[model samples]
Target chain A: MAEKKRELVSGSRLVDENSLKERLIVIFTKWEVILAVLIVFEFILFSNLSPYFLDYFNLMNSTFTFMEKAIMALPMIFIIMSGDIDISIASIIALCSFSMGFASSHEIGAAGIVIIGLLAGLSAGMVNGFLVTSFKMPAIAVTLATQSIFRGISQAILEDQAYTKYPEKFAYFGQGYLGETLIPFELVLFLVLAAIMGFVLHKTQYGRKLYAIGNSKEAARFSGVKVDRARFINFTLMGLFCGISAVLLTSRIGSTRPNIALGWDMEVITLVVLGGVSITGGKGNLFGVLMAIFLLGYLKFGMGLINLSAKVMIITTGLLLIIAVLLPGFLDTVKARRKLRRQQKESGMVEV
Target chain B: MSIPTSIKTITQRRETSLILLIGVLLFGVTMRAPNFVSVTNIERIVNDTSILIMVSIGQFFVILTGGIDLSVASMIGLSGMSAAMINQYNPGMPAGFVLIIGMLIGMVLGMINGAAVAYGKVPPIITTLGTMSIYRGMTFVISRGQWVTAHEMTESYMNLPHGNFLGISNLIWWGIVVSVIMFYFSKYTKRGREIYAIGGNKVAAKFVGVEEKKIHMTIFTLSGILSGIAGVMWTSRFAAAVNETAAGFELQTVAACVIGGVSIAGGSGAVVGVVLGALFLGIINNALPVINLSPFYQMFIQGAIVLVAMLINTLSEKRREQELLKGRQQ
Candidate 1:
């Protein structure tokens, strides 16, 4: 009778173990679920706190506040995922915008000005890529130097002058709304771009290579991954995106200055990291990043409605960044402790 | 053979190239502006760079441990603002006392960062980056977006930087004293050697019984204390304190360390190299205005110099490795 009781208990424990595995898998696979819940929570909290938060027009207009930054964050995801960073993105925007402004001042056509802006950004990225790949320079140091150089050039050229001569139609990219809809054109662009980026990062073989390289560069190289090429392309893509962001930002502001988008690199990086991308690399998804952008965008919007100072908003963002980084590790530790306790209990029961 | 050996030595030691570059720059500036080399002008340059030297010394320690403190500039601003506010409120508070208070505040701030990085397992860059904004925001909150003007500052506070100590300015004397103390500490102390070892190979160092967490906290705290001291000196020298004061100086400090041949990768740097780095930047800054160059050129020149210095360092390091490989083959 005792032997029979032991067999029954052991069988029940097996069932319990299977159920636990399923629960763990669900939790692990649904990382985006947490982010989605947080977004809803934030939406509810903000709308209840401020009267103006629920207005469609106010919400649409608010997207412009961070649309440029969101656009850049798309490419930043890939860069960070590949175990590299491009802090020079903001500076690239400054340089590209300044170039566009210069071209506009010289009576260049709108199309020509746009082309010049894109070319300038591409060239800047190429320089960063070349130095990093050829010389084996640390990406952070290389970009940091280029950031200074690019911004310096803009400062030298502009010298406190604001350029406002862009053609009227150019404003459509930044300020226009979808016809009869409350959606912003820039938001539409962001969504389309995010889809493309998501497909590329999640569905493509190149993306897998990026993860491999990020996890272990030498191992990835030995496995025949073209690490250098991928890194170079990612950086170039970063510059290209920066060019687009510059156009959008300049259009929205209706002017360009050397210091435009100054210190924005930090904000963009915060968004990317908050989106679940690891700073040390090799893990993250675009879905989390999209949710993060909206989370922060609305957070700022809600705060703005309540008349919080910019300094306070910045502090909140910083605190949010720290929390976002710390929370995952905290959760993992908690989960691990629980599992350990469960194992101890199971073993004790088995012995009994 | 002798000439080649001397040349090799000059190139092998990074500081020698920096010193030679400084000499070349001075000669060029003196040629362009005859008064550039005057004792008064030289003294002025030293005075201007005193705060820079102090901050760089702190940054060097953090970087030597393969970590960075991006919040140093913000710490400077906060400490300076705190010092100014204390002076404003008390009016009778001694300058020395206020300085100590400022440093204590900085230490508390640094401890927060150290705890986050060491105990919380956050990367140093991310931790410092987050704190940078938080501290800067705190500065605004403390000052209520107000500036402390020269009129509100005590006479002694203003005199701290300008006051003569022996034959040199008080600021230079402070730099000299700090550098000497740091030099001795880094060279003679077991903790200092452990910092370098940890930077060189973290896992190996840990296996050898180095308490990395404690050392990380200590270095960051040290950096904060030094930044606080620099803050006090900055406010004294300028006789004004504002939330934006010392903005972007963190990058400048890092640049100074890099230019002085302090590897950003860490494990190798010296107090002497860092001081020379500050002096090099100071001379360039002083010479630019005197040479009648556009103020705009200064930013470009500074960026170019940093980039070139890094490139040179990389090339030299590569060559050194190649030589080592060749020696092994033989």
Candidate 2:
């Protein structure tokens, strides 16, 4: 009978733990649900606003527009979550694009072109990471300087030249579709990249280290996590991704200009913030970021379809970014108040 | 008070980064074009220096607060466009009024930014970044994508740049006046020291009863005022204005401040250093045009110089920290 009583207590404790887990999941799932609902609402609203918004071709083009942004946002997630930032990604893209232009001028094949572009991006990223870490500089400052440095290099190489002599097959990566449907190659690439990044960030040890480092670098350092190594690797990864984006962008535009990706850094950063990542670091989820990426991309695309100027689209992006960064803190305050109220009510009843 | 120790201490803490950067820049320019020192070249340097000085002064204030005003350039563009529109609408209006109106509009925008950053609790970088888009968008909206033509602006107004005052362009005089005022304010004023105090330790300053929010707002507004002045100078000198004018001026301004020893980390730097840095940058820019070097090569070299400057600053900072550690150990 005593054994049975002890078993009952353990069973109840298990139940309580299970319920706690369920509660956490329930709260976390709300963000995804809200995002899905938002997307559906946006689609319905846009379709009502514009007759052509529902067109497969228009939507397909919209996917292409957001593809590089979404792809680049992945590494940026790791970068920001690790308590660092790189605003030079756009400039990195320019450098990569310019390198490709140089390669094409030298009659290099596609494979060689890809390698060279990636190498340029990696070197740029490494330099940025090295400077930031070794010199103990802020990531923002380092990247700001590198933005000019990389873009300056690109301008030096390409000047006003537009490179366009690639084979028609090259266009497939940016503009073509899979199985002759309405999807673009860039969209497919975005999906593949997003999945890989999600796995790396959510399912890997290194990913956990990123979270730990962001939470507190000192703690992570004491815990045997290699802080600088992770940062350096992540920056290099960001550059590699940026290089890939350059390849897609060059193919899509069918030309390369020195100013091709000018001012894209802020947009990517905006998306990263809107995805619910704390700019101050330590906390974020990839899924929410993906949701935000699509939400923003589609929202802008929808706005574009309704005849908004590109300028207005940028303004809207800025607003969304501000709201996204601030909203989570507001919600936490609300949650804390509610918890306090409930605790007070319970204590009052017990006293009574 | 041993000689070697004192020498080591002075050497460790001194900001030799800017000095080294200036030396390197002088050497590079001298090598590229030995004749880059002609009177004609000096005049060119003065012309470029005027514009950079205006922007650098504004950038210095924002950087001092441990925040950046990315919208400064956009403000310049917006104000330039507005000032030109006013000139085109009524060529007879006092040029001074047009300049004031443009600057006032800029101050308003900056106030909005400061309000968002200080009261709304938005991060300064993000706030300024947003305002940048807003400012530039407003410029495009107001101008309707039209350029302010040279003919629309009056010859007398355009002549202000070509005109000389005290054997220097009025533009250089504007730079000098603004720099002197700023240097005086930063060095001698109570609010100026408060700016440094807040940057050095915001928590400590707050503990000591520093009004953080007010100072932030003031600095941001001041930055906007300077940017507006720059807009006026830029428009008057170019005799034209467009939404995309001064496209990269914000970066250039920041570059000048950084190269001049203005720390991005904040609480450190001076207006005088920034002015000298601006002159250094201006000389480099002007020399490129005179030497007939590819503007592309000039850009490459300028970027390299900025990198080298940052590197030297980092090294000097490390040396200082090492000396401090050594002192503690001894």
Candidate 3:
């Protein structure tokens, strides 16, 4: 009884009300937290810079624009963490969209469209997974091949013509607002997904397995973590998300062109990395990813508001990606220099 | 001992198999299109192969170090534009100086990529991917998305590649010379060996005091110079430059490298192999258009061929690894 009480006291002290300030301190020191703070800062700055920036209509438009790619990015985070990548996501989305469009032309509605889209994404992902796993081909190589393959299929089906025969209601998934506040349905879906993924990544055993698998597949396998199964599941999940995004993208654009979202895979990766997720994997938070999403969305929106050319926007993204990657290294260098200075001050000489 | 033996056996088989495959493909294409074997068609193939070889040689170096340079297409566009503008803007300027300036522009951009990849520690894919846009974007901004036509190009600059020796295209001669040099450098030079070393094991190389940053910068810059030269050659050939010119050439370059047996994972590839790979792709590219396939279909076929080549290469490599593993056990 005495030992149990002692344990309780120790646990209580760990989460003591007085330690809330200390907790906040910890959060501020974290990279993800810093990113989150920067995003909020940018949001405010943009809102102030342009009256249109904070308008509900604008936000909704941007959210819908980003949703399809963002959804695919969630699974991509897992794939990249495992020391692999899927450059074929954009292609997969194209294939799915094309499949849905094909089905719609055949007079298939709603359910049939969803099924066709999902199957297309699934089969594409399966091919990618099999090629990488069985052939031991680099994920980049496999995905590069599949990117062409899937897009080829899309091209074969649609040729130069686009599909636009979808029913009017389907557009709601992409362009509809929830209530009168101008919050998009797609954005709401994104938030719900973000919340669910956040919970899974931060609070579940399965998420722990993903990190473990990513860090070292051999070790994970030896530990009975089912590494291959996890990867299969991850790829499937990526496909499912791709299918979902297809529905939104096809509807939002109101057509399916072969070149729709030609280079979106890179954009998804940029957001993931910018969100403070390690490209090397085994370490990332959805919170950081969320902040990155908003940060990118707002940055583009702000840049657009300023009337920057599309070319300039492309350059800005490139510069931003480079800066985002280098910032951590720069910070580490600065910290090291400070540490050396402090040590020299204390010891009266720099350590050799 | 067993591993070495099996490796040798596999290498021997691959060499013969690749040679046989090319022969068969050549026969098939020639049978289908009787003109494919003619001197004029051969000339066309050589011309196409020359540009692709130049670009692929650079691509081979980077991919041998397990990195991709998506900026090759943009590099081509930028350098081509620069060369054209220099010739047009500065009348009576020495062709050599203009060429040097164009090459230097490529070098600078390549250096930026190297710095970002090496010192910045950004993934090569992300770095090059970003730079791909930035370079092309800058090209548009500079050119205002305008094309430099033959009227704007100078006569001397156009004359550079038109003068052929030994009944061979000068560009083909250039490709052969560059390939030979690259082949020698990759095989015999210390810097060349150092590149393979970095690709093989960056961590191990670091332990042996190999400066990874320096090597990465060097290779990436070399890639840039090669692409730049191609740009110059391309502009001279067509006497035209546009922002969208050579837009998808990076993928083509990549295809050449991969099909040439340059492992995307880095290490263990030969410059000669890549040159041959470039020739293989060049053949397909040359023949496809003669058959009256639409431009779009041509792209689809080219992409499919690349995918097939990669699949084959990877399958062979995997089989070799399995053999080595099994040999060790035996």
TM-score of each: 0.95, 0.90, 0.90
Order of all candidates by lDDT, from best down to worst? Answer: 1, 2, 3
lDDT of 2 by residue, B92-203 (tens): 9888788788789778877888888787777788787777888888888888788998999987667656678878888878888888999999999999989998888999
Best by TM-score: 1
Report the lDDT tens digits of candidate 1 across residue range A1-352. 2544774575476567678774654455344677788788988988888989999889888999999999999989999999898888889999999999988989887788878888988888888888889888778778878888999899987887889889987888889989988899999999999999999999999888888878878989999999999999989988989998998888888899888898899899999998989888888889999999998998888888888898998898888888788878887687667658878997999999
Instruction: Give me the runs in candidate 1 sitting further than 4 Å from their true place.
Output: A1-31, B1-11
Residues forming the 10-long window of minimal summed lDDT in candidate 3 chain A: A21-30
Question: Which of candidates 2 and 3 reaches a greater lDDT?
Answer: 2
Report DockQ per prediction, comma-separated.
0.70, 0.47, 0.59
Among these predicted structures, which one has the highest DockQ? 1
- Fnat of each prediction, in sequence: 0.49, 0.43, 0.53
- Model 1 over residues B126-205: C-alpha lDDT tens digits? 89889998999999999989999999999988887788868899889988898899888888999888988998889999
Candidate 2: docking tier: acceptable
Task: Give per-residue CA lDDT, model 2, range A252-324, as digits (tens).
Answer: 8878888888889988888787777777677788998889888888888888889988888766776766666
Report the lDDT of model 3 for residue A321. 75
Q: Which residue segments of model 3 deviate by more than 4 Å?
A: A1-29, A179-181, A337-352, B1-15, B159-161, B291-294, B325-330
Cα lDDT tens digits, model 3, A1-352, are 2544873574465467447764554346467778777778888887887899888778778777678777877888778777678888888999999989888999987777878888888887887777777677778887776777788778866779999889777778888888776788888888888777778777898888888877778888899997777777777777778888888888888899988878898889888877777776776777777877877877877878877777887787777777777887777676567547745775775443
